[model samples]
Target: MHRRQNVRRALLLVSFLLFPVTFYYLSPYLIIMGAGERTASGSMVVFGVMTLTALVLGRLFCGWVCPAGGLTEALFAVQNRKANNRRNWTRWLVWVPWIAVIILVTLRAGGIQRVDILYQTDHGISLTTASGMGPYIIFYAVLALIFVLSLTAGRRGFCHHTCWMAPFMMIGRGVRNTFRLPAVQLSADTPSCVGCYACTSACPMSLEVQAMVLSQRMENSECILCGTCVDVCPHNVIRYEFGRPRSTNPVRPEKP
Candidate 1:
């Protein structure tokens, strides 16, 4: 477990370093704009790829690699408070409407006639072609937004409330759950949990880990599969596994 914590920390640092470059090239706002300019935008392609990846791997992208995740993790040093994510569902309001607009724009554009992975990217890098301080100002503004949310609302507040990227992954994860497909996930042996709350304390997303451990339900859509609960458990109560879930929805037969 200690080993896993060390590995996670290393991965977090690498992700933080990659964020500036990643956001410049793959910013969601730009991607949203591209959706109307053309049918199959590079941002759309990336979103599709991310969804497919999440279908197989769950939210490991959020846990291990999201630039926003990296930023939030870095900010935890300054403010290590737990987040109140009860309003997380409100993100769907923003996501659903934006997705509807994307569809409307694509239809208005007469469908995807061409594919260009580098549509918005300037020479394959977003920062390289910035004309003036405008790009930098926007970039810093984004950073400040994330930072301020973390400082005021708690860990990953931006993720819970404002991120445009997470909803795509969450929807993909929901598809996995609905199909009961094999994916990377955490499972628990509830008998082994000591109820010490260590796992809860370590969770960056501020989930009620003890409740999840107690209920033996590690399948929450909000879970990023970061494995902090698994790592902090002195009792080895939690562990990663690959398998299909026994969905609560029962399969029904058609009328004969």
Candidate 2:
């Protein structure tokens, strides 16, 4: 388990280091900007892929590949507190308007007239081929925001409250759940749980994973399927299960 976590951290760090080259493909603004120009940008393709991936893997990208997530996780050295999960709803505020604008602009442009995967990028690179310091400034500005949010709001705070990209995967996860499609999810053997609560403490998303186990319900939209809970449980009471969920009920922890 420890080794797996080390690998996860290493992947995150690599993703973060590659942010200079990949940032534009993950930029939410670029999608809308592309729509206005009737071009299907790389961001559009990337987001679509995220949504599709979520249908089978459930936000695995956020857990394993997101540059912002990588940055936030690195900031854990400075501030490792769990983010206030109650504020998770705030991300929709950013996503809804942005999605609406994308639809509006795309329609206004009579749909995408071209597929320019390199929209706004210089020959597939984000920062290196830029004309001036504008790309560099934007890149650092984004990193600065993630740095502040992670340190101040807590671990992965940007993911919990401000990520425009999360909603796409979340919506895909939602659809999969609504139809009971087979996918990766956590399964808890309630009888084996010893109530140690280590899983809850170890969860980067701050989910009440211990409580979810006790209640025998593990479905959570915020669950990035990062497997931290699975890896941390001393008794192996939790694990990854790939299949249609046994229960569609929302996780409701029993009253102590």
Best by lDDT: 2
Please list the C-alpha lDDT of all candidates, in the order they appear. Answer: 0.77, 0.87
lDDT of 2 at 120: 83
lDDT of 1 by residue, 12-122 (tens): 778777665666444766655666676465667778888888898888888887777888888988998988879887678878887787777778867777667767556
Best by TM-score: 2
Tens-digit lDDT track of model 2 for 1-256: 5888888888999999999999999988889899999999999999998899889999888888888889998888889998899989999998999899999999998999898889988888877853588778888888998898888888899999889999989999999999999999889877777778999998989999987887777988898888888998988989998999786344443333
Off by over 4 Å in 1: 129-131, 246-256
Model 2 misplaced stretches (Cα beyond 4 Å): 248-256
Which ten contiguous residues of candidate 2 have the minimum total lDDT?
247-256
| TM-score for each of the candidates | 0.90, 0.94
Going through the candidates in the order shown, the clash numbers are 0, 0
